[model samples]
Target: MTVALWCILIAIFLPYLCTGVAKVSGGYRLKDNHDPRGFLDSLEGLGKRANAAQLNSFEVTPAFAAAVIVAHLAGNAELVTINVLSVLFITSRLLYIIFYLADLATLRSLMWFVGMGLIVSFFVVSV
Candidate 1:
């Protein structure tokens, strides 16, 4: 499969990664109550950050999916271009999560910008 498509797969899985982090950070257990919202609300520090990362991932996923679909439909964007931009976005997102969990606000912001730029690039390249 194309890397861009793989990116979609990665995007789908990213939220689960965040959830896993949140669970561990918040001391969640299998038998615990499933009041996720409550649990997250009570979280602080890394736990809070993990929940935020999950939320952010969900927020950005639609735009990223739309951009990739547009690029596919345009049929003009080069495969290498699509792959590189896809990798860039996913890499940035991974960095975003790491930076956020580590409380590196500046780095997280930078990765956010980079990921957004790559999303925009998909549209621009399609044009």
Candidate 2:
């Protein structure tokens, strides 16, 4: 599969990674599984930011995946271009999560914008 396709898979699972961080850091217990959302809602600081990042990850993943898929199907853009944008999007998301956990709101927002721009670039390149 293409690198951009692999990135779609990564995007799908990225939220789980963030949630794992929140759960592990927030003192997750087996019993908490019964109320996972509540457990996450109770988290603070790093845990809270991680949970928020997870949610944002979920929110953006569909668009990113769609952009990659559409770009591939459209066959209008160079494979290397699509792959580079996909990699950059994933990198931006990783940095976004880091910035969020570190409470760097400005940097986190900047990363968010960069990821979104990468998503849009996929579509623009396809056309």
Candidate 3:
């Protein structure tokens, strides 16, 4: 449960971190409606990606939480690996968001792979 709570915390803050980065990069104001096409388009894309990242976090977090819970119930020590991997997944996801916003497609893909690998690895180890 504690691990799950930490994962949730990371999930909640990851998108906000991306949003803050976008603002710093002059992407767009959170509430601004007056921007040029280029800025608006970029900002919209950033917002969408941020939202997508949040949704992805939600998608994986439950599987992570369930894995941990099952491990606990089964008295398995493998949950420790899953917990660590969950943290790694969250960190890699944040990196993915930054790379995505910077338009580093290859790096973003690599980071995404790392995150996905962690999630899949967790499931494999949990079972």
Among the numbered candidates, top lDDT falls to: 2
Best by TM-score: 2
Candidate 2 lDDT tens digits, 38-103: 999999989999999999999999999999999999999999999999999999999999999999
If the candidates were sorted by their lDDT against the true structure, best first, what order would they fall in?
2, 1, 3
Residue pairs of candidate 2 with colliding backbone atoms: none
Off by over 4 Å in 2: none
Model 3 error, position 21 (Å): 3.3
**What TM-score, computed on C-alpha atoms, does each candidate reach?**
0.96, 0.98, 0.63
On the 0 to 100 scale, the lDDT of residue 99 in model 3 is 79
Candidate 2 lDDT score at position 6: 97
The per-model lDDT (C-alpha) reads 0.91, 0.96, 0.63
User: Which segments of candidate 1 are over 4 A away from where they belong?
Assistant: none
* Residue-wise C-alpha lDDT for candidate 3, range 46-80, written one tens digit per residue: 65555455455556556555655564565544666
Candidate 1 lDDT by residue in tens digits, 1-127: 8889999989988988998899899999776676777887889889999999999999998889889888988998998998889888999999999999999999999999999999999999988
Candidate 3 colliding pairs, count: 0
